[model samples]
Target: MAELSEQTGVAQSTIRSLIRGRLKRLDSISTGKLAQFFQCKLDELYVMKWE
Candidate 1:
């Protein structure tokens, strides 16, 4: 999570919320940035359950 935040330059809280499926909405620019950071599909980030 910290790596994601650092890579995307997004706050840890925001990343945590997204990962937890608790974020109500996402900013397009931030989403694109995260997608790049993870090197995965944008939708893959929001897993419904914790792993």
Candidate 2:
């Protein structure tokens, strides 16, 4: 998670929330950053589709 925070420029606390499933939603910009860090597509980050 620290690696993700470092790579994506997201806060460690934010990443911890994400890992713990505490974050109910995320903005597209943050989502994109996480996806890029993981080398995955944006769609892969979410189970439900967003309008």
What would the per-residue lDDT of candidate 2 be over residues 1-51, giving only the tens digit for each residue? 777788898889987777666786668788778877878774555543342
Candidate 2: clashing pairs of residues: none
Deviation from native of the Cα of residue 39 in model 1, angstroms:
1.4
Candidate with top TM-score is 1
Residue 10 deviation, candidate 2, in Å?
A: 0.7
Give the range where candidate 1 is weakest over 10 consecutive residues by summed lDDT.
Answer: 42-51
RMSD of each: 2.6, 4.5
TM-score against native, each model: 0.70, 0.66
The models' CA-based lDDT, in order, is 0.76, 0.73
Q: How displaced is residue 14 in candidate 1, in Å?
A: 0.3
lDDT for each residue of candidate 1 in 1-51, tens digit (9 for 90 to 100): 778788788889988887667885779888788878878766765553443
